[model samples]
Target: MDKKYSNKGLKIIAAEIQGSSKQAIGKIIEENNVGFTVTKGAQGPVSIAGIPHAVAFGADGKLIFKGHPASEEFKDVVREALRDVKVVKENLGGLVALGDVIEQRTWTNSEGVKMVAAVTKIDVDKVVFRLQKNGKIVPYPISKLSEEDQKLIKGMIEDE
Candidate 1:
């Protein structure tokens, strides 16, 4: 699936939250030749009631599907979501092109705490951070961020 949709901008991340040891997980990944990122944590904002559950997020960072991966509906939803997605080259560092989707990013605050989130909404004095950890939307004053972060936000706003 990764090879099939990678060029179409489908990013898959598997979060292993069953408390498996890192070494054991590494061995399993090596043994199976898994190709995507597998983090050891709970998926933020998504609730899974059982194993093999799947969730799909569209290019706009919106939840679009939740169900078993083997279900037919999952594939249909994924295909539809990628229908208008622009291809993105992996690991190439540059600004997102006009009409390109904004993926998750790391942000730091004035106290030096950091989190991985996407900028959901940016107001004049505040920004909404959608945390990838617990699926929480945090409202933060733009002034409380580090100088570098503030500049980053400014750049994003300028691009708009």
Candidate 2:
């Protein structure tokens, strides 16, 4: 017998509000016909999956929205809710492509550390890489680097 598998894309929408609490954001989400799950975690310079982009509302409202990062509609809804708030900053990452199973390969980094990463998706010539470094699927910008660097990185991944 033979079996087949399919690939499904994961889409997430997230938000970060400056002056409101998670509970407050929940209420707003409910009112806006959107759903969200909030947890206590660190909001930092790095893009953490499931964490929303922070937006500040008034002097006491801070909220964040997390969903499909590639969904423009989801982003629009979050933007509308935050229409009255001041946007401090927008930190978001794009989609990545984890190549086919047959071509999936693992490579080592500069420190002689073994790493597994896959090409999840590509955006505007930027290749999104899923680095299995910290047990999390983190994305890195491969298109911004120099041509030589890009080739080097691609070679490293393709090396058996």
Candidate 3:
């Protein structure tokens, strides 16, 4: 796949086709012909809601924006989503989500404090875990963990 599209870490999808707006969209389809899939059958939001509307989905397939695709607000939202994706990738060394149930694990920190926790979120410079003892979410610096723990956590600080 072209990095121009894949590197963005998200795909653009036009979910509904109906109304007089199809004329203009048809023209675009003919001009671009970039192999976007099409369905003769009707699908999606069911109601027109409106025409020429845009929607954006994030890497995790959640809607991030809804408006005219060309609108500045839509573009700004996409830009921000992309930036967030990049930041996440850098922090986790890959993509990850917020509430995934990271398997239960125990680790001892450099100060010899052994903590058992389930992973919550991986931040720019810390690993957030829900401490099993008190169910409190806390951020632990990767550096503070024991070498064995750090190695184990590093491999899993991202999406399952």
lDDT: which candidate is best? 1
Name the regions of candidate 2 deviating beyond 4 angstroms. 1-8, 35-97, 100-160
Q: Candidate 3, residue 103: CA error in Å?
A: 20
Q: What is the C-alpha RMSD of each candidate to the true structure, in Å?
A: 8.4, 15.1, 9.2
Task: In model 2, state the lDDT of residue 84.
Answer: 54
Better of 1 and 3 by TM-score: 1
lDDT of 2 by residue, 1-160 (tens): 0011111212223445355787787787688765334443446554545434433222233434444545775556545553553322112122223342212246444344455766554444445556556545445565555565467556545642
Q: Candidate 3's C-alpha lDDT?
A: 0.62
Candidate models: Cα lDDT each? 0.78, 0.44, 0.62
| Stretch of 10 with least lDDT, candidate 1 | 92-101
Instruction: Return the TM-score for each candidate structure.
Output: 0.55, 0.24, 0.40
Greater-TM-score candidate between 1 and 2? 1
Model 3, 122: alpha-carbon shift in Å?
13
> What does the lDDT read for residue 18 in candidate 1?
87
The predicted structure with the larger lDDT, 1 or 3, is 1
Which 10 consecutive positions of candidate 3 have the poorest summed lDDT?
A: 86-95
Segments in model 1 whose C-alpha atoms lie over 4 Å from true places: 88-98, 101-160
